[model samples]
Target chain A: MGTARANWAFLLGYRFYVAAFFVFLAAPLIAAGSFAFNDSLFPALPWQGFTLDWFFNDTEPKLGMFHDRRLLRGLYYSFVIACGVSALSVFVGTCNAFLFVRTDLPAKNFFYIVMIVPLVIPGVILGISILAMASQFANGLEEAHGIELGFLRPGLPLVVLGQFSFIATITSLVITARLRKFDATMEEAAYNLGASRLRVLTTITLPFLRPAMIAAGIVAFLVSFENFNTTLFLVGSESPLTITMFDRMAKVGSTPVLNAVSFFLMIGSGALALVSVLVQRDRTKV
Target chain B: MSQRDIKRLTLFLLFAPFALWILLLIVLPHIGMGYLALREKIGPRQYEFGFGNFVEFAMEPIYWNTLLRTGSMSLLVTALALIVGFPIAYYIAKIANYRTRGAMFLLCLIPLWVSDLIRAFGWILLLRETGVISSSLQAIGLIDAPVELLYNDVTVVIGLVYTVMLFMIVPLVSTLDGMDNSMIEAGYNLGGSGLTVLRRIIIPYAMPGIVSGCIIVFMLTAGSYLTPILLGGKNSSWFTEMIYEQFITRYNWEAGATFGFLLLAFTSLVVWLGLKLSRQTLAGTVARS
Candidate 1:
């Protein structure tokens, strides 16, 4: 609208600032990923010829992330946890959406605020609180009846619960937003046409909510995969990839192999995010 | 079955999951944590409920000081993210070509998709003494010695601002996107300068988005553990670090719970203050997203 009277100097400065902002966003990630290919032992710039050793080497000084048993196991643990978390979060989240959006539930506003509490609190506190409750429950059980509950200890189950507590809130937000936009009259019309409630839900409403469910699932998966603060407190002997990587980084500083892991994570998360965006776009168009 | 029976069934199905989630995850845990925090260790295996843990926190200067520092640093990070993110949000929302807006928005989301740990690792690669930036400066003869740029407050702020940038931008863009172009044109036609129009019309209209963005950025920054530790290094002195120490290192659950609650309480207070100052409700703040 102001093109005819736009300030040239301001425009130039604005362009420069935007360009710099993009660089600021991208530079660290690119720099980190570049070192993955560096042949140097230190992940630094000496222009030592690029090699696949960081990703391929098997032994000792230059162990590849793929070959590192500990890291691979950690990745496997993270995957299993992510799967469990996403499934639980999406299921519960959908139930939550139905409860909040479609029903004339009592104290709905109070419940809604309670649901959001998990999202606002620190993940560290979330992890700690879950840990405390589980341990206290476990301890009381042991004290009163000499009973032991393995899941109540710092373990994968607790990790899943901690992650799910907040991740479910995200999924609920997603599913609820889409559900709020849904035309409930369609279900009423189906009922008028002699369709059962279950039939209407499964055949019509579920199909409509599929995209939001899928998008929320993908988001839940990604969040669970990369989670650290919560996982750190609740993890048992078997560490997640984030914990493993952080330990390695803290103990031994930067290695090209860690950089290699970063590169793959960037690609993996980027692809999933792209899929989520496309799914949401598809929903919008529909 | 009667209609009453069907209604009962539906209610049971819906209320069960929601009740289980809130009670088991949210309500019980916080209650348990509160119990833990209130305990005073009287003997090896004996405990009694008291406010000793909270009292200790108030009595210790180092503890309270670290808490204050973490709060202030988070505030600074929130401010910085808003300042850095506003124009970019404006660009994407109003200035970018309609066809390219989606693509531009995607570009912003790309960095955030990568985990916070990886993002911090990237900063390490760039800011470390032997990292790219210092090395490049050396290669260009800008300096003779490698500068250790990592493990500092500035680096931590930079990492945090970068981490939370997308959050601020998204809400701002959404709010700004709803702004009518005719209003800006009206402002211009009325002889209002560009800066005046922005301050009066654009910002006021985007105030909800701005407040929400600030709230999210502040919450994320305050609760953040990895960025402050990884970027600020051993001297980070972040309050979360103290809580971590109490829980993981010292095995002092009582003290840890106390610190955790203090962090939660203070951050909530700040968030409440922020909402009040901006005249936005918590629901409204969250709704903007």
Candidate 2:
């Protein structure tokens, strides 16, 4: 009887715990989502009659966020940075995966350990550190060589570089996971059959890595698109969606339009994520 | 080309990009910052090498206190995330129907695709004085008036937990899913109560995942910038904000560099302690990260 009672208690506790967790997870999203359709200027309650004004309203006193040039430009900047970072990180990260899996190097583990340092080190620190390094390098050039490279300035270029530092580690991990699953014997067999190194790579290894590379590229783009902490310090004048949205909320104060932006992001990310998940699921299944 | 020469060339071709990128960006930046951290900045473009910044940080009660506060708060968040996340992870990994597991995992993953700024914004929309929770409580007659809930340590911690909960959950689920079910069944079959079975079998088995999850959550929380600032407001006194103040507001990169290193050192020390306590290796943790 005691054991049965204890079992009942455990089951009840488990159900309650799961229910509360679901609430905790869904509450903020539901509130923010509801505010998207809210007619109220502020994203607070009182059930201001529903209107779609915040999303597409482009007139004075009710200008929608979509019509806001600054916000749109921020989104454009996000795309540019994400594109740059995804390309650079995937290229270098794939190379790293190849080297780590395919070659013997001096202190390979040490290289790996150092490479992943950006993973644990906070993005803020990484941002300022790079800024410091760039400034010092620029100072040296100005004092010694008399050349000032404008690219060193905090801008989109710096934002890309700063983001790529860590995102590259992520890309490498994804590619390397795929790399490790390949049999070395197959490569040796190709080589023994008189295929050139380049032929083996293009014809065999690249095919094996394509799915992972595509997944990594998509993820890298998303990660870069949403990066905030590092970009906050590294960006000069331009703002991405994150920083622009932050400025809107913290500095300019809240608006329902931010809710509209949130809703838009939800739909976009949901669609993209659905595609990526399906692709990844298909790859793993096959 | 000679065979040995060809092999050397191939090796060089394979490694140059990664090696050069790491050296140029990752290694040099920290070295530069370390140099700046060691210096004394007195005037524009004028500096001297010294322990002055470190000394200043040591002397300032505010610096130490903020560090202590941020560290403690991160610990609290990490603990809370573990308690809240473990059961959910267990449910998804062990209890959920096998066919629906993919859907459940995707559900947990969906929020993370949103930016941290937006996630914190969601909290602000809910917890503000004029926000959803307070106004709803009033509507339901649970409160006499709307009481402000924004801008406090609790709110900040909750935001931190919310932002990084997926990080904790992913590792825990991965670890839990890899376990053999028979071991758990064996414990149950041995007349062990549920708690006893969990204590003797499940928790021990999930220790690496727990350690890795805690380390990642703690690192991210301790180093977090957005949530504390947005939710905790001015009195957040978060260490990263101080680093930001020195870097941007004060234009004192010297002090900011020192603070950055301080955060790194402090977090590494804590992570080292966690690693020691859990008997997990850094390499194991890196795989999870």
Candidate 3:
């Protein structure tokens, strides 16, 4: 696979590029996490004698983020939204997968292309568009029924919906990747045995799709949990963890405790990602 | 019900809910945004449709310059992601064995799970005036004082390149993993040079993935608001930031809607051009990924 004399220069250059890429990928995460243990107020270098003060100190100078009620509450809101979005996106995205991969519809590609429009559209456009649409719809409902539907305005439900608009699209694509590889002969065999459509859908298609749904569920939850640009304008009185963290970092001049939060978050997502990988690998093995 | 009717009903039921959802949320909202983009508000509760919004964008150099800057910057981000990501994908797919390939593939993916906001903050920790880079240099007596490394285009480019590289790599890995390695070996057996084999065999095979990755990365980078805002600071001239300002800060929905459509248009045009040049179908590229 190489010249008689190995191109040591190229090999070294290639290895260097890969090593540099890995550092580029992992440095910020490692840096952010390392500074969390620093006892200094700022997260810069010259690690001021290591301490767990950021995680537990409740004193005036640097308060432990773990004991912070506001952050925890924001975390709570994010959890709720993530869970709600997971449920919604799973149901909707699974149905979307079935629609694209299973059904016999004219202009199927058109539907798929339209569905994919969201993936490329930025969160800003979706946020403003959803805001404008919801406000308009709420106005119409108010004018027509003399009812103020505050739910249409902004909240967790709206956040979930806004996130779902694209999350579900992504989910469907994930499941469709599986669906395309699926052997339809199983479904045909079930039908040949006089199994009803409902029974076949439940017994054959649903069973086969279970793993994909699980994978998509994890992604849906992660996407919903970390979402910011779309969730920012859509969440009302209840801001999610990302928004709170953004406010603290960009606006309030946050402490190194924010670094501590980033540390915990990196560890947490790493664990969840590990779980997702296991689930995916498990499906392949099965 | 008749068997055919029941079958048709089942199909319809299976598709209708998602169809209606997309119609309501994804499609109509854009239509609303488009309608808003075309109109101008003359007075309170009074509106008129015109090309004034587009004209305003053209009349203002700052608006157009920001648009052009965002275009070039996003293109740079896309190109850098492709350049940085291709080798990693090749390493994961071709060099790594079955046991390690999956693990290496997930390495590129792990960053995505971390939120973009935090990722940007991480860079700020390292690149800000009193940040790690400055402090380390100062420690080594490279410079006497903390240097201003933040609030610049370089920071924004680094942040965006990091943000979108995963999008590029994932598709590349998937596409390359599916490729038969024997083909590359055959090219070698025929005495083709390494660069010749890559240009003729691998690049052609990976075009769909390459194009799809570019489309996704470019769109995400261009539409991105948080990373540029955080890393590039107050003067960061991302077009999405402009759209956000028009809609949120200035309360000008019409102008904001126009910018939103313009952003969408620019991204779609880039994607379309990429697809055309690569001779790839959208469905084929997305399906491959």
Global lDDT of each candidate: 0.90, 0.88, 0.86
lDDT of 2 by residue, A27-137 (tens): 887777778888877888777798999878888577788898888999899999999999999898899898888788779888887777778888888899999999889
Candidate with the greatest TM-score versus the true structure: 1
**Tens-digit lDDT string for candidate 3 (B100-178):** 8877677888999999988888889888888889989998999999898989998899899998889999999989988
Chain B of candidate 1 vs. true chain B, TM:
0.97
Interface RMSD of candidate 3, in Å, is: 1.2
Give per-residue CA lDDT, model 3, range A1-286, as digits (tens).
4653478777777778887888889999888888889988888777689989888887767888888878888989999999998888888887777777767877988888877878778888889899888887898889999999887898878888899888988888878877777788998999999998789979888877777888888998999888988887688989899999998998988789899888888888888878877776666764
Across B81-199, the per-residue lDDT of candidate 1 in tens digits comes to 98899999999999889978888888898987788999998898888898788999999999999999988898889889998899899989999999999999999899999989999
Point out where model 2 deviates above 4 Å: A185-194, B43-45
| TM-score for each candidate, following the candidate numbering | 0.97, 0.96, 0.96
Model 3 alpha-carbon miss at residue B37, Å: 1.2
Clash count, one per candidate: 0, 1, 0
True contacts kept of each: 0.69, 0.71, 0.71
Q: Write down the C-alpha DockQ for each prediction.
A: 0.78, 0.76, 0.74
Give the per-residue lDDT of model 2 (tens digit) for B1-289: 9988987887899889987788888889999999999999777778888999999999999999999999999999999999989999999899878977777788888887877877888899889898888888998999999888989877888889999999999989999999999999999899998889999999999988898899889999998999999999978999999999999999988899999999988999999999998888877776754
CAPRI quality level assigned to candidate 2 from its DockQ score: medium
Candidate that would win on DockQ: 1
| Candidate achieving higher lDDT, 1 or 2 | 1
DockQ of 1: 0.78
